[model samples]
Target chain A: MSLLVELSNVGRDFDGGRIVAVDGVSLAIEDDETVAIVGRSGSGKSTILNLVCGLDRPTRGEVRFEGRAVNGRAAWAALRASRIGIVFQNFFLLQSLSARENIEVALLGNLGGARQRRVRALELLAHFGLAERATLRPAELSGGERQRLAIARALANRPKLLVADEPTGSLDVQTSQSVMSIIGNAHREFGTAVIVVTHDEDVAALCGRRVEISDGRIRSDNRMTAMPTPAPTLRIR
Target chain B: MTELTLPLRGLISRPLRTLLTVLGIALAVAGFVALTGLTAGVQHSFASGINENGADLVVSQRSAFNLVSSAVPKSLSSGLSAVPNVEAVSGILLNITTADDAANIVMAGWPSDSFLWKDMHLLAGRIPAPGDQWSVILGESIARALDKRVGDTVELQFQPYRIVGIASFSSVLNQNSAIVPLEGLQQLLSREDVFTLYEVRLKRPLDKNDIAVARTRLIAAAQGFEVGDTEQFSSSIRIFDLLRAIAQTISLVVMAMASVAVANTLLMAVNERTFEIGVLAALGWSPRRILRLILIEGVIMSAAGGVIGIILGVLTMEMAAKTNFAAGLIVPYLSGWSIAQALIFVFIAGPLGALYPAWRATRLLPADALRRI
Candidate 1:
């Protein structure tokens, strides 16, 4: 598989370099792959995900997307808009927008017109079993439903890579399993690669590869020969 | 679904904040509209009064604070009329007095047979006849305010005079004025043989150069007096200048406060929506788009306030025109130019007020913003 994103010896610092968030990290994500990054709180697993998604800039290393070096805010924003999608732990859906509108917003510059965006948003919502709740605002939705809406919004542009920072961190076990199943379905159906950051071993086990980090540095990396067990049938309700 | 949807939703979600901010801007714009409208009305009335009288030149006391304070000797009328190209000259005495039922009524005095009286189109009754000392002609507006008709008695300065005619003039000032024989007014005011100013009419077909030459001759002949053409005299009224300056100054201060209010509201909104903004950025919305969203919100609020303010100001001025204190004194005139000025101000203020907040929103790092609770 071709590499979709590559990070070389990336370092990030805060407070004028007094705090090191990520250090000496080099990683590559290929097309159609599933990778899980696991670490304790503040171990820089989320920071790595940020670098991979171009949400945060590295202080000392080069980050490349689709073989071009990402150098400016505009370049990163363009890449994120067209090629990368991100899901957050808190399900950061716009509270004011309806579920369908939230999805439509992601398609704004990437899509042709309002009508096309609306039709596509509806299709995504119906695929996620959220068609009936398309008019509901994020505040009116349950935690799982909000997360599903967020995921639908992320995939609205059909991004090549999905970067999720603790996709199931705020959900109950059953809901987490259901969300994992949906993520697996997206990977299989869209041929999209995913990078998930989490502390849960069960969540990490669902990915084809696992990378462990400690003290802002990668400690271990492993690739399993066997395909991750097929996710259980998704129960959207 | 459109570009405005998210920003509009954000504003609608915070109903009270949006309303208060709009009201604040509305009040400022209203003040601008009302004060500027009143001042413009004054200038218009003064110019119309001059232009309507068919006066080519006006002679008044030099450096006088206002037309009411200007005094020129009635004896100068003959000399002014003798100036080359001068066709006729009329001496006028002006005063302000309250009638029994009306306050702030303008009283203007002209000769019974002066050409100035020719401009007054009598709607009813006859003009003050020669030797009629206790007769007055009421402008249509003042007649309406006092509810008096021709031949009815109206009391001015504790003295009752018969309304001899109901007349209409082009200017609002004249329309709301009471016209009397110049000698009768001079006798009443105890200033006989002294007039407020002299209105001069040059021969028809005279160009501006001829008028200028005649004005110079009049100035030279009537030493110690200022002689200007109608346009100059109309524009030189100190009270009109003062009113305009005051209106502009007050409007500036009010607009500044409104801009600050808009900025404060937008800042609060940006602060409250930091997380949502981060989500937008993460979703691939560029900083420019985020900035545009915030600006659109501010502009929407300001534009709304501007429309509301214009309506409020017009209504307020109309109401004030009917009040006892302002009756016959203020004519609310709202020109298209004034409305356009107010709109331009609010439009400029919108982006100006939102600029900082939008910049701050753009500066937020998506990762850091998403980290917020």
Candidate 2:
């Protein structure tokens, strides 16, 4: 697999260097790889995810996507538009848009014409099993449904990398398993790279590789024998 | 999806704020239209009244602010007539007074032999002959307003005059006036041998040079008087200029207030949607796109308001024209130029009011904004 994103000794500081969020963190993500970053609160795992996705600029070191340096706001925005997708813990689906429109919003300007975008958005909704709730707004959906809608929106532009920050932090165990299964399915179906930042150990156990961070530095990087395929259906208690 | 989808949805989500902003802009635009329309109407009526008489030149007192306040000696007519190429000269006196059941009635006094009387079309009955002291001709509008006809006695300033003719003139102001014999009006107003102005007519088949020469000669003949063509004379009315200035100033103030209201509403919307905007930014939307979204919302609200305001203003003027207070006096004149001016103001105000808010929205960082709960 080719290297999709490489962070070279990235360091991010807050409050004018008085507080260091991430220090001397070197990480590399490969195409079609599912990696889990595990850390406690304020342990810089989320910061590393932000730097990888171009959502935040590092105070030191460089980030490269496809062997080209990513600099300036315009460059990062272009990358995020076509190459990277992000899913927040809260889902953050636009309340004013319906389930289909939420996915359509991300496809705008990056996809084909309006009609094509509509068709693609409907297809994504159906793939995520949200076809019946296509017309429903985000607020009207359940927590699991809203998270699925967010995931569908994230993949609308056919991005190469998906950066999810605590994707299932707000859900119960059963719903978290369901959301994780969808993420694994997305990786398998589209061959897209996945970087999930979470503190839940069970969530991290499903990935092919695990990286543990402590005190703003990587403590252990381990690779499992294989990435376990998630169950197709949620199992009750 | 089109670029306008999100902006349109944002406005629809907050219907009450959108509605209030539209209403505010509408009221401002309505005030602008009505005030400017009324002033323009007055100016048009004044110019039409002068043009309808075919007067080549008008002569008024140098110190007078308007024709009605002008006082030139009636003897100037003879000297003005002696000027070379001068075909005819007519002297007139004008007054504003309350009559029975009518307020602010325009009373025009012209001699029976004057050329001014030639343009007054008699709708019914005969024109007053010379030496008819108590005879008067009522304009069609005032006749309809007072419900009077030929041989009906109407009292003006407690003096009774028998209506000898009902006449219609080309201009609305003239149509709303009452014409009387020159000497009788002088006797009634106690200002005999003094006229408001003189209307001069040069011989026909005259070019611009001939008129200029005649005007110079007439100026030489009538000293201490201002002489110009009908257009210049109409534009020189200080009262009309003052009314137009006041109307424009008030309209500008109202437009500024509306712009401020639009700005405030947009600022609040931006604040409330900070997280959503952040999400859009994170979704690969550029800063320019976000700015455009906010500006489009403002412009949509303002455009809708402008259209509704124009309708409301026209209806208000039409209703006022039918009221007793404005009967025969207020003629609402809505010109295409005035409507375009209102629309231009609305369009300019839309973007101007949204500029600061749009800039503020663009300044929000995606990471920081997403952190905002």
Candidate 3:
């Protein structure tokens, strides 16, 4: 497998002098791999996802995406728009536009004609069983519906790498299952490199590998030998 | 040239705020444009009123606002006529009188064939014949008000006069004035110098010394004599200038207030849509593009407001044109130039007001914007 992302000795400091967000953490995710960062709040799990997605520049070391350093604004912008997809905790869908427009808007940042983008947005929504609800605003959507829309918007650019920060942190357990299932289907559909920063053990269990962070440093980096089967049983019943 | 569709969506997302801010901007620009329009009209009318003379000097009673009681003896006209530098002098009496219906009208008595009548545009009918004492010339306002036509007879205070000719007005809403023969007004006004003052038409413009030389002779011939050039006549031009300054100052203040309203509304919008702006930035939109997008939002608001205001002003002006309108709603102005200037003012103001707010929106870091989300 090819290396999709490599975070080399990344460290981040905040609070002007006192607090450190990430402490010299180094990690790599291979293409087609599903990785989860599990930790408590502010344990630098979100920070690691942010750095990998090029949302924030590291204070030390380097982040390579597809084998190139992205430290400047322009470089990060290109890396994120064409190569990466980020899903946020709060389902950051623009409230004014419809769900389809939310997904269609992402096409403006990518390479395609208007008609093609529209067709693709519809296709993605239909695959998620949300074709009927594509015209609805974010305000009209449920929490699970919002997370699904966020996932749809993230994949609009056809990114090779997908990074999510607490994507299901605010949802109930049932809705969280629905969100994870939807995300799993999307990851398989696009052959994307998936990385999720979450606290839920079930969410972490769905990923092929889990990396734990403690006080800004990685404490565990291990692969799950056997994936969970609770989701399949719930779907059948 | 930024991707403004997203920013525009942000603007409409909060419709009430957008509407209020846009209205505030429009009102300001309207106030500014309308006032300046009036100023331009007033000044133009005054200048046109005096300059309409092809005359070098206006020989009237000094400082008299009206010519009704300021008549110079008719013999002064003959004396001015004989001066060496003066080519011709026409004595005219302009009286503001009421008809039996109590509507105000201007009645002027001058020699029908004199050059002064030539200065007045003839909309209809022929000039009054000599000894044609009972004939009248109605200005546009009086003609419309009384519903009189050429060959129609109107009852004056003393006698019935035929509406022989109609005189053109500088403005549609200008007061109505009539023209009759000088002999006719002497009888009605009951005075010998029924002619208010003589207008001296000079053969050529005067140099400084010639002006001084002409000044002495004009005063000796006609008492209360004053002379003014085409550009320096304050009596006809200054009132409009003062009015114009007042209008200009008003528009400036309104523009400032409008700018604040626009900026305030945009500032709120920027803060509220921070995440959206960040999203666009994350999507590869440059900060400059984001700035332009916000500025476009401001300009669109300003433009919408200006269009509403101009429509209102023009409608008000048209309505005033249709009625007697005792107070002038349509001031004397250069309409085309004034409206053009007003539009330019709005365009510049819209962009200027949006500058700081757009910059603030652009300054928002993408991560910071998505922080809460």
Candidate number with greatest TM-score: 1
Error (Å) of candidate 3 at residue A229 is 12
What ranges in model 3 sit over 4 Å off? A59-61, A172-178, A185-189, A224-237, B1-5, B43-175, B178-242, B282-285, B316-334
- On the 0 to 100 scale, the lDDT of residue B318 in model 1 is 81
**Error in Å for residue A173 of model 2:** 4.2
Per-residue alpha-carbon lDDT of candidate 1 for residues B1-373, written as tens digits (9 for 90 to 100) = 9999988988999999999999998999999999998877666666666677888889888766776777898788778888888888988888888877556787888887789877669999989989987799998988988799998998875678899999988777777888887777888888897888888988989887998899889998899988897657656667778888999999999999999999999999999998888889999999999999999999999999999999988987788777766665677889898899899989999889999999999998888878775
Question: In candidate 2, what are the lDDT values of residues B83-143, reduced to their tens digit?
Answer: 9899889888888776675555778888889988777799999889889977889889888
Per-model chain A TM: 0.95, 0.95, 0.92
Of candidate 1 chain B, the 10-residue stretch with the lowest lDDT total is B41-50
Could you tell me the lDDT of residue A83 within candidate 2? 85
TM-score of each: 0.89, 0.88, 0.73
Sort by DockQ, top down from the best? 1, 2, 3
Candidate 1 per-residue C-alpha lDDT over A54-141 given as tens digits, one digit per residue, 9 for 90 to 100: 7888988989887878887777888889988898899888878899999999999999999999999999898787899999988999
Error of 2 at A37 (Å): 1.8
Q: By lDDT, is 2 or 3 better?
A: 2
Off by over 4 Å in 2: A8-20, A57-63, A67-72, A172-175, A215-217, A229-237, B54-64, B71-73, B79-87, B100-102, B149-162, B187-194, B200-231, B320-329
Model 3 chain A is weakest, by summed lDDT over 10 consecutive residues, at A228-237
What's the best-to-worst order under lDDT? 1, 2, 3
